[model samples]
Target: MQRVRVLVIDDSALVRKLLSTMLACDPAIEVVGVAADPLIAREKIKQLEPDVLTLDVEMPRMDGLTFLENLMRLRPMPVVMVSSLTQQGAEVTLRALELGAVDFFTKPSNDLASTFAAGAQEICAKVKLAALTRPRVRTIVRKLEVAPRLSADAVLPRAQTPDSRGGSRIIAIGASTGGTEAIRVVLEAMPPDAPPILITQHIPAAFSGPFAARMDNCSAMRVCEARDGQPIQHGHAYIAPGSQHLLAMWDGARYVCRLHDGPPVNRHKPSVDVLFRSVAATVGAPAIGALLTGMGDDGARGLAEMREGGAMTLVQDEASSVVWGMPGAAWKLGAASEMLPLDHIAARLLELARQPIARAMRAVT
Candidate 1:
């Protein structure tokens, strides 16, 4: 079997050595070369033609982001960013994802050896995952003119009525590898009065806050990170905090979001399975579950439960997925009510939202 060749780029000698050592420990990974800066890394890329590149965010000569932008435009290849955990680091790392980075690893601040020791398996796994994903060309994002944010309660149709104690409608979404872009594509197409959305996109704690902010800037809906015990309001999309499981619970009057600090389910904190199951158990038939481009089966079983409970389930087709692992698994289990390409998902969701509660209830029965 051919090993995945990797090029390590970091300004810190210690970081380069530590990363090289961690990657080398995995027999399937081969350290082709290491560069102290992007200038040196640029030449190494031409020479070695590594399968993956581990890049640092802040680097000498040229910053990683600028280099990455050029690389994606000139020669698109899978690149995993090794970023610091500071506020600035988080912001830039999110931009790297926007610029077509396959994934990222947060640099440990203290006790580097011990931290990397704990995360060695994760690092190698991400590298392997990156190797399998197709590299996308970085495109120039046209800036949208700033507009006033609208409240959902003001414009969206109310799910509640005096005649019935009907539950609120929600859309639950989950993704992992290549999820940032996937989530962005779905959210960007959402109308102003779209259903309340809850998302669990596998990410580290430091990056989640910035990611929510970025999503808010790109989408029409009010996007924010989920907080413990927060009310699940209409016209707002909530992203699960990176290190916690987001659960939907009823508080007598309305459905609210709750964060759980339990052991990782399916080896993922804020696991897609955790979120999907909560929506299935609490929201039931009023929910819509979407399993998009990702690398694992974290959401397949939970999505099946959602389908059994009469909720609509959609999976992105393999042709449009970066890895096709999660949605493919869900499709194989007969969990998906509809399987569509990424471009059509948002429109399908809006169409589902148009169905009257009476009709949706009938379908559930």
Candidate 2:
């Protein structure tokens, strides 16, 4: 098997060694070199041209953010961040994800082994997936001027409703990088009565509240941050919180949101995988899944699992994706039942939702 080349960048000698050793333990991963900071890492990147980089969030002379911004802007490469596990760490990690890092890990706590043990499968899985992801292409994003299609007029806790249309179908949306705007375009086209939407978007902790607030104002659907114990209802939209993995549960008669801080699902908290898999298990053939543009294959396998469970699945086509990694990965694996352009996504979803669920929808059943 060909090894995935990785360069470890950190100021701490112990961390550099720890990550290198742990990552190298995977037969498929190779530590090309270790650098104390970005300055040295840059020179090594030029030399080794490694397949991936594991970066520490804090460093001397130049902080990780400055270095990461330059890395993505100048020579785009897949970067997995290693961050401290503090409140600030979570905040910075989210910023790193927005700035184009493929994924992240918390600086292992003192009970490092237990922490690693809890999330090793996740870390390794994400790193492997990151290796196959496409490099990011820089684009200038302009602020939106028009209102969203699904914004709610009044607050009803999580009871807020959009259009009264009922779908025999449910839709699961997974998006990251540039997802906000992409989702807006999709939601705007939908009728007030749309399918119950459960979205897992990669967002920073500080930004999620603001993001949900922004979405609620623009879109006709009642948008709110996912809360543990909250019930999922039609006409309501759930946005996964920044630091928690949002998983759906079949609570007897209704679906409820569950918050988790267990290992990073596909290198992300509130991972698309957790949401996709849960939906796959809950609704089975009655679900319509859409994997939008993002930085990696986080949702691919989970969506594939959903498809296996007889759910209709769509992946965003490349032309419209800011970074086509997530959708492309799903496409390459034949996981997507349909490949739809971003412009057509909302309508396509509505069309699919309007259709009656059939045993034909049960690919796995």
Candidate 3:
């Protein structure tokens, strides 16, 4: 098996060393070269021909974003961002995703070496995942072995019967890795008075609020990080807080958001499985579930449950996904009623939103 060759670019010597060390810890990743700035990295990229790149947000000579824009326009390949955990960092990282980065991870504010060491597994995994993305150097498909993890049951129990309590239709969406940009594309295309959207995208606690704010700027609908016990309203999109699990619950008379402080389901705090299962139980046939571009199979099982409960389900097609793991898993499990490209999902969802739940259920059945 050919290992994933990587180029590490950072202004900080310590960071460059730390990143290289962490990546080397994985047998599947080979640190081919390191660069102190984008200029040096540019030449190294041509020389080493690395399969993936770990780029720093702040750099000398040229900023990471500028270099990324140039690289993507000229020679596109998978790039993973290494950023700080500050508010500014979160904003910049989101921009990097929009600029076509496959994924990102924040460096520790203090105790850099120890912290980087502790996150070695995650760093290596992200690099390997990036290697599998578009403009690939080679085709490398390997199933990563993950430790046993808790399911949606750890947060919310599966309903014996679909709740069927809500009067209006609801939309549930989940994604990770390449999801931020994909979600932005879908939400930006939605009409102002579209059905309420509930989203779970795997992200750090510091980034979710900024991500929501960014989405709100471009999307016609009001998009915001969800608040506990908030009323679910039409023309609004609610994103799960990075630190808590956001669940859609029918509060006797109306649907509301309930935030849970449960253990990480599927190794994620704001897990897609938890949100999807909650929607399946509380909204039932009136809900529409879509699983977008992401790494891992976090939402696949929950989407299947949504289908069984009579909800219309959709998965993003592989050709349009940055990483097809989540949506592909759903496709393989026969969870999605239809698999569509990223550009067409919003229109299709709006079409379904206009139909009566009973008729939509009949169509899917």
Candidate 4:
């Protein structure tokens, strides 16, 4: 088998070295070349002509975003943004994905080990998967001025909402790819006083903060990145940070979040599986498990586990999924008690919040 060839592009020599060496350790990946910035990378593209490019968010001579914009216009290839762990970094990484890069992984600044420890396998696998995709021709795609929203086909409205007359039940959401748009619909449908929501989106650590802020500004729900020891509350939403796993723990009657720098699950630091499993144990049947659009089978198995544990499970149907990987997997497992479109996820959860059976089961469990 031909090893997946990769081009490492960064302004920092140390980062170039670290990234190349780490990727090289994988038997299926080979470091084709390393460039200190986009200028060199542009030249390497013509010379080495690697299968994939690992792009840095910021670079000298030309930044990764501008270069990526040009790359997609001229010759499209799969690119993954390597981002710093900052709000600014988060914004750029999200922009890169919108601009045509594949999925991103966070690179911890203070500790090199943490960056490589969790995402090593995923990095290699993504590079290979990306290489197999049809490469785009160099044509100036008018940058989408606005992120695409899910069409009605993408969402199925389940029930009318505002279950603000609530109990302690909260919402747990997991999504990938088209999730940004899918989430927008669900959150928009939610009432301001809706139950507390916990979300795990497969995004880089650098991007979760801004992503949450973006959602907060757009939706009725107040969204923020989850912090350790933060008590689970009503009327607010917490998103799992990119570089850590967000799990829930029950202290007597109250639930607080615990953040751990553990090895990645399903090749993601803040894996949906980890969060769903934690909710299944902590909130039991009270929480609603929603599997949204995304690539791969990351959250499918875990959502299924949640359903078996007696949670009301909702899977977005294939018509609504951009990739149909995660939600489809859950459906195949027979986990989803209700299969709906992306638009309807919020209404269904609201109805669940109204059900005494949901909270009653949790209290007993």
Q: Rate the local accuracy (lDDT) of all candidates.
A: 0.88, 0.78, 0.90, 0.77
Measured with C-alpha atoms, the lDDT of residue 77 in candidate 3 is 92
Q: List model 4 lDDT by residue over 1-365, tens digit each.
A: 88888999988787788788789988889898999888888999999988899999777788889999899888888787788767777777766765677667677777776667577787777776666644333222221123334445458764654332223586788987656656666776676667788889887666778888877886766888999999877668898997998887776657778888999998888899998989887777677889997888888888887887777889888875656789888889887888996656777788887788645566446
Tell me the tens digit of each residue's lDDT in model 3 across 67-149.
99898889999999999999999999998998888889788899998999999998899999899988422111222223344
Q: What lDDT does candidate 2 reach at residue 184?
A: 63
* Residue 195 lDDT (model 1): 80
Question: Candidate 2, residues 275-323: lDDT per residue as tens digits?
Answer: 9998888778788889998887889999999888888899999987767
Estimated TM-score per prediction? 0.90, 0.62, 0.90, 0.63
Model 1: pairs clashing at backbone N, Cα or C within 3 Å: none
Error of 2 at 79 (Å): 0.7
Q: Runs in model 1 with CA error above 4 Å?
A: 138-167
By lDDT, is 1 or 2 better? 1
Per-residue lDDT of model 1, residues 159-197, tens digit only:
755331245689999999888888888888876567899
Q: How accurate is candidate 1 locally (lDDT)?
A: 0.88
Q: Return the lDDT, model 1, position 54.
A: 97
RMSDs, each prediction?
3.5, 7.2, 9.8, 8.5
Error of 3 at 245 (Å): 0.8
